[model samples]
Structures are given as C-alpha cells and as structure tokens.
Target: MFHNSGKLLFFLGKADRLRITVWLFSLTVITIAVPLAFGNLYPTQAERDVMAQTLSNPALTAMVGPVNFETYTIGTMTAHEMVLLTALVVGLMNILFVNRHTRVEEEEGLLELVRSLPTGKGANMMAVFLHILFINLLLVLLISVGLGVLGIESMGWNGSMLYGMVLGGSGIFFAGITAISAQLADNARTSFGIAFAVLMIAYLVRAVGDVSAETLSWFSPLHLSSQAEVYGANHWWTILPLFGVGILLFAVAGYMASLRDLDAGLLRSRAGKTTASSFLGTPTGLALRLQRTGIISWGIAMLLLGASYGSILGDLETFFEGNEILQQMLAGESSASFTEQFLSLLIVVIALIATIPALMSMLKLYKEEKSHRVDLLYAHPLSRFQFFASHLSIAAVQGLVMFLLAFAGLWMAGVAVMTEPFSFLTIVGAGMAYYPALLVMVGVTVLLIGFFPEKSGWVWAYLLYAFIVLYFGGLFEFPEWMEYLSPFGYVPELPNEDMTWLPLILLSMVALVMVTIGFRGYKRRDLQG
Candidate 1:
C-alpha cells in the first residue's frame, strides 16, 4: 500500500518547497517577534499588570481566549494575546496546504498522471501524510528554538517548547480535518468549502466556550491548545487530545480513500437544471453565478469579524490609557482619542482583508481560462472586453459592499456595547475613505490577470507584504517610504487625521490606468488553454 511513498513524498516537497518555506518563515517570525516586542513594551511589572487587567474584559476573552492574569509576566502576556490567534492562523495554513495537495492536485489531473506509473494505490496518500507531518515538525522546531534563543526571563526553554507544540498540534488537527474533507467532496472548491466551514465552526465554538462555558471549550481544538497555558502552568498534557484526535482523523481519511474509486468522493454533486435561465447566458450574469457562493461566504465572515473587533472597542480607553508603547505609536495624533486611533488601525487591517474576496472574484477568470472553460465562451460571440469588464465590475462592487458590511457590523456592535458611542456617520466616513485603496488592489489584480496570467499568484504575495508594512510599520518604526509601497498608505488615517482629496484622487487615477492597460493586454494575448 505504501510502495514508492518515499519518492512521492520527495516530489511533493520539491513542488511546494517555496510555499512551505514562506508560511513557516512568516509564522515563526511573528511568533518570536511578539514576545520580544512585549518585553520591551512592558518593561515594568506595573504596566504588564495594567494591561492584563484591561484585557480581562469579556469581549477580549471571546476574541482571544481567557488571560492568565495571576502571574502577568511577559511570557504570560504573549500567551494570552498571541496563542489563540496564532493557532487560528496556523489551522488555516494547514487546511489550505492539505486541500491544495490532495483535492486541488486531483482536480488538476496531476494525481492521475502519478497513478499511471508504478506507484501503489496508497502511496500518494501516504506521501501527503508524511509531507504535512514534516512541515509541522519543522514549524515546531523553528518556533521552540526561536523563542528559547530570545532569552526572555519568563519565556524559558520548557515553556517555549510547549508553545510550539501547541501550535503544531492545532495545525495537525486541521490538516486531518482537511484530509477527511478532501475524501468527502468531489472537487477542490467543495473540499475547500467544507474544510473552511469546519474551521469557522471550531472558532465560533471556542469563542462561545471561552466567554461562558469552560467545559464546552474542551470540544474545540483551538481551546485545547489554549489550555496548554504555556509560560504559566505550562500544561504540556493539554496537547495530547489534539495530536490523538488528529491522527485518528487522518487514519479515517486514509481508510476512506482506499475504499473509494479515483476521481470520485463519498458525497456526490447534485444535478443541475436541465434547462438554463436566460440570465445565465450573459457574461455578467455568468460571472455572478460562478462567484455567488464565495461572495456570500466572505460577506458574512467579514460582518462577524467586524463585530468581534467592535465588541472590544468599549474597553480601548482603559486598554490604552497608560501604555507607553501604544502612545508612542500614536504620538503624532495627540488631538484624537485613543479609541479613534485604534479604529483607524482596525479599518486598515479590515480593508486589507476585504481585498481577498475582491481579488478572488477577478482571479476566477484566470482560473476558468486555465481550465479551458473560457475557450467555450469565446467560441460564441462574447467579446474579450465584455468578459473582462463583467468580472472587473463585479469585483469592484463586491469590494465596496464587503467594506460596508464590515463597517456596519462594527458600528452596530460598538453602539450596543459602548455607554457613549461615536457617531455612525463618522464611522461610515472613515470606512469610505479607504475605498480608493481597495480599488487600487482590484486594479493590481486586473494588471496581473491581464499580462502575467501564469504569475497571478504574485498578487497574494504582494498583498501579504502590504499587510506587514502597513499594519506593523509604525509599531516597528520602519522608514517613511516603506508605507508608500502599499495603496493603503496613501490614504489619510480617517477621523483622526483630516481627509485629503489629492492622494485619494491620485490613487484612483493610478487604478484607472492599470485597468486600461490590463484590458488592452487581455485583448491582445492568446487564451491560456
């Protein structure tokens, strides 16, 4: 059953080496950097205690798991603030990694080609398992050593090791979930949908459990990792359930894979209508239909995310009152309230996130083109301009709607929680100020899909870079020019700083030029498939 599994594992590693490296490096850097920063930010025990007390509110407990304020050292603060959030991100990474290798490869026919050779039936699945295991192991080693090397008083070697193990355990648990999802769904899209849905459910369960019911939190893998309590109690035993359940799920997936035929799944796709509606025949209608599920899902998620952030706004004044580090970050703005400054920061991050679905909407055209589906549409009278414009228009409009939903959610929730809420119009204006930056992102997507179709993935990489620079630049004291590298940097931080029209206008014009050039390239270039 495992014939040539070693060779297949090496092949898989070679194929994904770059992606794996980037994820590992990013996660490791963030994990280590946070503790180092915390040490400098809260040098005195008094500041740490104040921060801990401020974070003790129920809103934050729901967002990040409960804090261990008993000790309240740098390590404890790091664990309180970073562990649950980092675990959530690591779970996402594992889900995407597993789904990409398993279902995505199968959809692209790469697995079929492999099977035509002398490989055993179970060789490919075994290779996938080993690949994921290797990646998780490397992550564990990197984070543990990285933290230990920092030599912080509270973050000792043993506690660092426990922290890394918790992260690795959460990742493996999600990888197992995605593996099972791959076996159950026939296509990559359905497989990804199922896996992500499970991830969301886990997070919501954990959030609810943390706020109200301690026993219920035990059901969530995220909560299990939090239970480890690294740098505090350092409950090493809490990690057992994660690994145990993860391996069990992997075994169940392998067995299911062995029983099923190639290119098929346990859950069958439902049959479509025999006769299509007239609207489905048009380019705009077709694009909307293809992307409807993703748009709706992203919209709801953004709304909920905004609400989560909103829940904590009422406590920001207390959270930021005596924190020297945060005050330094916002030193330029003495006139604005701390909550407003924090709101500006939150809007930037949220806008960056809202860009994902917008970009995906446009990139779907490239995906379809690669699959040769676009060739059929071209066989009819549809013009390149019409097809391109349809997707571009949908992306632009959806981006705006997503931003609004998030802002609306934030405003509604903030009003409910705050004794004296800020103006609704102020929040709306602040959010709308970032819309031009969002357009620039959509324009960049168009530029990529138009000319460098094969390298469309670069947009995501650029987005990641933009996020790091825009979100962390101030905190890290990066050079001024670094902020200009991202579109979000050009726009004024709203409600805190007065709105300026020149930069926003310039951004919009830049987007217009990029879109125009992209359309021209699309018209000239040959179709991919």
Candidate 2:
C-alpha cells in the first residue's frame, strides 16, 4: 500500500528547494572543509605542539570532545574540531527539517489535505523519515569525498568513511528525538524548543563528562559521534546504537501519532487567561511576553556555556606551567596575566553567541507581520512605533541581561576554581565590551525588516555571514574589509588588547543611526502582511 505513496519523494523535493536546508547543508560542508584545510596548512612541529596543547585543555575538550593528542595528524586534527561542531550543525538540521514537515505542516492545515488524498495514515511520518535518511546519506557521501580529496593520511579512506558515517548517525539520532518532540508538543515552535532543550542538555552532559573524564558522555547521543573514534580506535560498533535508538523512536512516534487526532498533539496544552492583565495591554509588555520563551532558552544556554569556560580558568595556570609553548600561545611576551587574556577572549565568544537571541528578537517584528498576527495586534490602539520599539527594546534588554548572566556564570566558576582572588570588574568589563556589536546586530535585523519586509527571512543569512566572519575569518585569512563588515570586528578584543572606547562609541552611533532609519522606513512602507 505504501509503495504507491509519492509523499516521500515529494517532501524530499520540497526540502531540496528550501533556502534554509540549502544554507544549512552548505554551512555543514564548509564547517568540515575549513577545518580540514587549516589543519593541513601547518604541519611543522611547533604548530603541531601548539595544536596538541590547545586540544589538551579541559575547557576546549569539554566544549569539543577530547582530542587524541598522541595522533595529532591533520586528519585527527580535522576530526577533533569537526566532530562536535558538525554533529551540532547536522542535529539542528534534522530538528528543523523534521519539525517543518510534521508539526508545522499540521499547523498550516496542509497535513489534512495530504491525508485527504489516497494516502496511508503513516505516509507523512514515513516520508519524513525517508527525507531525513536521504539528507544524512548525502552528507555522508559529501564528507567522504571531501576528506578523500584533502588527502589526510591519518584519516585514510576507511577512517574518512567512518567519520562521515558518525556525523550522519548523529543527525539520524536527532531526527528521532525531534520526531518524538513533535508528537509531544502542540505547536511547531514548542516542538523546536523541546527538542533544542534536549539537545542542550545532551551537550552539557557530554561536556561535563569530557571535563571530569567520566562515563556521563556515553549517555548522550551527541557523544556517540565522537565515541566512534573515527581515526584512532575506529570502533564501528558505536554506530549501531544510533540506528537502534532512531528506529525505536520512530516506532514510538508512529504509535503516538495513532493516538492523537490530526492537528493535535499527545501532550495537552495549557489554556490561556480569560482576562488580559493591565501590563499586557502595553506593546512592550506584549513583545516581552511573546519573546519570553526564546529569551529563557538562550539565557540558560549562555549561562551554561559561560560556567563551562569559567570552570576551566583555575586550571589554566597549571596547564600552561609545564609547556612554554602553550604559555606563549595563550599570552604573548607581556606583563598581563594569562588567565585574564583567555577569559577575555572566552567572554567575547559568549557575547557573540548572545547575538542569536538579539537578532531573533529584532526579527520578531517581521515574523509577527509575516504570520498576519501583527494585523490583529494593530487592530487595537498599538502604534507602529510602539510595536517596533517594544520588540527591539526587549531584544536589547534581553541581550544585556543574557550577557550579565554569562559573566555571573564565569565569576561564580572562577571563585569556585581559583584559590587566589578573582576580579569581578574585569569579567564585567569583558561582558560589556560586546554590547556595541550586539546592538549593531539588532540594528541590522531591524534594517532588514524595515527595508525588506517581504524578504525579511534573509536576515538569518546575514546572521550566518556575521557569525562566520567574526569567528573563522582570521583562520581562513579573509580580507580585512570583509571581516570589518561583521559588527564583532569593531568590538575590542578586551583585556587581550587595551580597552579602546573609540570603536565602541562609533559602533554604537552606527547602530543608533541604523535603528532610526529602519524605524522611519518601516513607518513609511505598507505592511507586507
């Protein structure tokens, strides 16, 4: 009966055309390629020694899985960097892909139409599974070919194939997780949150395990990708559990689907209040309420990340003591403390990640309008300025609060780990250093909304562009002007470099101008919705 169902290929075609899918896939490939290319560029003993020491750090290992320092070849170097990050990228892909096809379709009233045709009850789920499977398989093939072309001897053909398979396995595992989350949540957004939260927890588990050198890492499916030991032990058995868990979760999703009515979830949603509160009547309050879920999610993640970085600070001195090479790499021939320099850079990274929420909040204006919800809000006494200002303010305020929490995490961890006195002032300054860049990102998103409401989704592409530029530009030796385009490029590197207020103040002014122009432009244009 299922053989005639064309839903599988149909959805695959649909996914193939989506800009989101295409960009994500391309980013994953770039993530792998960039690291591989860099690893091969410097094969000298000094460079390898530096790489070995960097990978040996507890914090770096906690973030990225422990590297096989004994086998720090280009292949292993590539694997060490790519494993954790690529798994995350591919996992997000599956989560988004699955949610779009399943819960999102049901929400948009398209699932009913699909079902009304001569299709089976399981057609949608089956189609989604097939779609995810194809994506992973294609990713595996791409990575294998890319690695082979790079000619990394340590990760020979077999090791490269295993590496690719491990990545694909992680995606497959998360595809099941998101499938189950979709069944449990009443809406697509809620499903994404549920799955994302689970992903974060899994990541933290692996981080804690890697840092403490414990067995907790084995419990996370995310850890499974790294445990495969692609170039080292080459354990093929590690891949079995991914398939096993995926099949079990798919079966459970199908059973759960059978129990629920179409467009409804297995979990019951809470009913809303009968009367709106006085504060809820205000636009700013309304915006805050709308964005609270995302704020909370990003906030917790940031705190966890910050704390992770902090916990390792106390060990930095010890880790650097024996190795003159690592000490020089971390701190140049300067009078400044090594810990401060590392902490400053780490805080900057946290603040950069905090941009994710800032941009999301700014783009919320476009989202509401695109979904036609803004019209309903505007039906009341809400002015355009109120609508725009409220959301942007929330984003700004939330970014500030998120940065503080991150700094607080660092401070708390520092106090816990350090026997000597820790300076809260330095940490606070580092966190605040990112404010200009954060504001600039929000401003850019607003500009996108104001000028291109119909194509406002393109703001995400801008975010990706900025992220890559700020984080990887130096590694890739990108042109200076191109890197300058990222707001982060203007932000001072903090304690590593002297705190310069000129660029910070100038960037702030630019952000202010951008916001003003966006606000004016949005007022003049007809509502896209």
**Number of the predicted model whose lDDT against the real structure is largest:** 1
- Count clashes in each candidate, considering only residues at least 3 apart in sequence or on different chains: 0, 0
Candidate 1 has its poorest 10 consecutive residues by lDDT at 325-334
Q: How many clashing residue pairs, candidate 2?
A: 0
lDDT per residue for candidate 2 within 1-529, as digits (tens), equals 3543465557656755666466546755674666455554555656665767767777778778887546666666677777778888888878888888889778767788888888888878887887778778878888877776776567688887888888888888889999999999988878999988888888888988888856888888878767777777777888789877876887789778878999788889888899989998899888887777878888888887778778888767656554543353343545667776567557767887777778778777886787577889889887899899899888899889889888888888888988874678878787898898889888887887888776666666766777666555545655769867777777766667788899889989999999999999999999874
lDDT digits (tens) for residues 279-301 of candidate 1: 98899999998787788899999
The TM-score values for the models, in the order shown, are 0.96, 0.89
C-alpha-based local distance difference test score of model 2: 0.77
lDDT accuracy of residue 360 in candidate 2: 76
RMSD of each: 1.8, 3.1
Model 1 lDDT, residue 278, Cα: 97
Choose the strongest candidate by TM-score. Answer: 1
Worst 10 residues of 2 by lDDT: 322-331
The CA lDDT of each predicted structure is 0.86, 0.77
